[model samples]
Target: MADAPLRSLFQQRFGEAPDLPEILATNPEITRLAARGSCRHFTPDQIDPAILETLCAAALCAPSKSDLQQRDILIVTDPGLLRDLKSLLDAQEWIADAPAMVVFLANNRRQRQLQAWHAQPFPNDHLDAFFNASLDAGIALAFFMIAAEAAGLGCCPISTIRNHLKEVRGLLDLPDHVFPVAGMAVGHPLRAPEISARLPLAKTVHHNQFADITKEEVSAYDTRRLAGADGPGWSEAKAKMYASPQRMDFADVIREIGFKLD
Candidate 1:
């Protein structure tokens, strides 16, 4: 039998059982700490500076591409600055209350400067540099979240920060070849959030090749998701989100930040 917490977490995530390695079923730490729910409500308490520093260090330890270490993190602590950031995000009042805010950046400028200093031929001027830096930042963000959760801190990633990229860049005084990937709000949770359901593993995981998702799978997932919520299901929610164009000019923003997609 699976461990109680693991089984419960599996049910909360997928609304069903999880087939997994036997080791996972028995490991207490993995069963207890592997699941995460986004927390928006936070207490008035502030995160310890030492703890935040340790978490940042742990996050930076995540793998890098060719040892380039292209990820950068900015810890935003100034109340005035945080309020300014919150102002940029419309309707997200929760951000104003969070005790800590950190911005993750994909940094390509370091490598360009390195090439200039070494007088080496800088051949990688295409989309790959942008892709690698963005991916590295994403991985580092994931590591940060894991470390934060393990430390009993709650976090919510604010991707909407991208919507105001120009304003963010100006506010942070970011130079060329550095762009914001995401912002994370960290603090103690006022209340534990409900676990969100996910699409079944079969719909996402493929044996050896890419598998097509049938309408039946989508319908089933929608049904499972709607059982505990009042809003539209995943498919309808996604459709509605995409039906209205969002950040159509993000490409332009990327170009403005000195990243060449081509």
Candidate 2:
């Protein structure tokens, strides 16, 4: 049998593609998932608030860990407020053009409040509390992006919001334990997003036992990335990014925000 178009997309994204014929029954959602990319350029067509609200509702319907429901979404509607927030992200030029933006949050405050309401002591102050909330936020973010793309909107996830955590929290009026995981730029697409390269499934997906990646595997992957429009090889680009201390103080900021990451 001929390889599915989804397999072609996977090959485009990862260089090496997995052949899973049994699961190759393609659908609209599967096609979108297979061809997903981060859209940076956007047209200035204004988004309807109702559409964004529906997207958020669909996103939040995603599975929560033990139904803790720690994730939330905040839409940026005010032009002036969004402008101020955009000022902090001047490095990203596309922010000025995107018609709408939303911030995904890890809101563990509600869970803690449940304890206060029930007159029960909140004993689990370990790292898992913070980890789980952050994970939930990420899951919702993924869902939101998928839904947005499906709805014919482009999206660019702005993780740099964490670089200005204190300012973002102040600007958005985020209270304790309700931290921004990431922000998304949403609007009509000016151009189609390029399929980003990913590490091959061989290095990423393992059998029952977990395995470490080999340097040769990474170098080969880096070579594949270099052959594309990306200027630097994957290893060199990532090494450069790691060299610059972008968010080393992130833990300190989150720690101050009432996450007892013990």
Candidate 3:
């Protein structure tokens, strides 16, 4: 039955099949979630702006932080603006292939506006404010991906948009307390995407008490994820990535843009 397909996908992703309940394993949406993957290749065909409009509307319906609704989306259609953004993210070569692009923003500024409009004291302008806004934006981005994928669209989130935060903020004309969370390259898929392996459930999912991931677990995971690839293992790759001094000023820079982050 279709349940076998879901089990197979779980095996591929986690190297261990799920003992899923039949009803859950058979649900099309649940199966789709298990098989989710990012697509960086796309055809030259363009997507209708209307589809994106509906997707954004649905994505915004996702849960928010304390009903603050501190998130917004920028649908980039202008050729010049898209070109500038592509130039900034050129390192991710496939970004240029996307027929549609969208930038998700964490907009804490709206909450600030609400306080000023009602003549209320804006006391909570510290770390929690920025954290809440960022979470709202992140949740909306996840919702957008799910909605887009359901509509047969492929997308890859580019967090590198934050690497050049100064230039991007300038280009997007983002005011204080509004920050770019990520950019998404969207289009119809040119080919089926391969699922990237993930950590085993034992390594991630735990009981009420938190559990730490052991080195052995990660080593086993690295072997599964790097089976065919000749690249470094996950730990080494991540270590190299973190060695860079890039974006060390991220918190400080955000403070300059109106988040006290105290």
lDDT (10s digit) by residue, model 1, range 66-167: 999999999987888888988898578888779999899999999999999999988998899999999999999999998898898899999999999999
lDDT of 3 by residue, 1-262 (tens): 6689888989999999757886798889988999999999999899899999999999999999879899999999788999999999999999989988999999999988999999999988789999998899999999999999999999989999999899999999999999999999999999988899999987677879889998998988998999978989998899899998888889888999988777
Q: How close is candidate 1 to the true structure, as a TM-score?
A: 0.95
Q: lDDT values of the candidates?
A: 0.88, 0.89, 0.91
Question: In candidate 2, what are the lDDT values of residues 72-174, reduced to their tens digit?
Answer: 9999979999999999999988788888899999989999999999999999877998999999999999999999999999998999999999999999999
**Position 171, candidate 2: lDDT:** 98
Over 4 Å off in model 1, which ranges? none
Question: 1 or 2, which is superior by TM-score?
Answer: 1
Candidate whose TM-score is highest: 3
**What is the TM-score of candidate 3?**
0.97
Quote the RMSD, in angstroms, for model 1.
1.5
Error of 1 at 137 (Å): 0.4
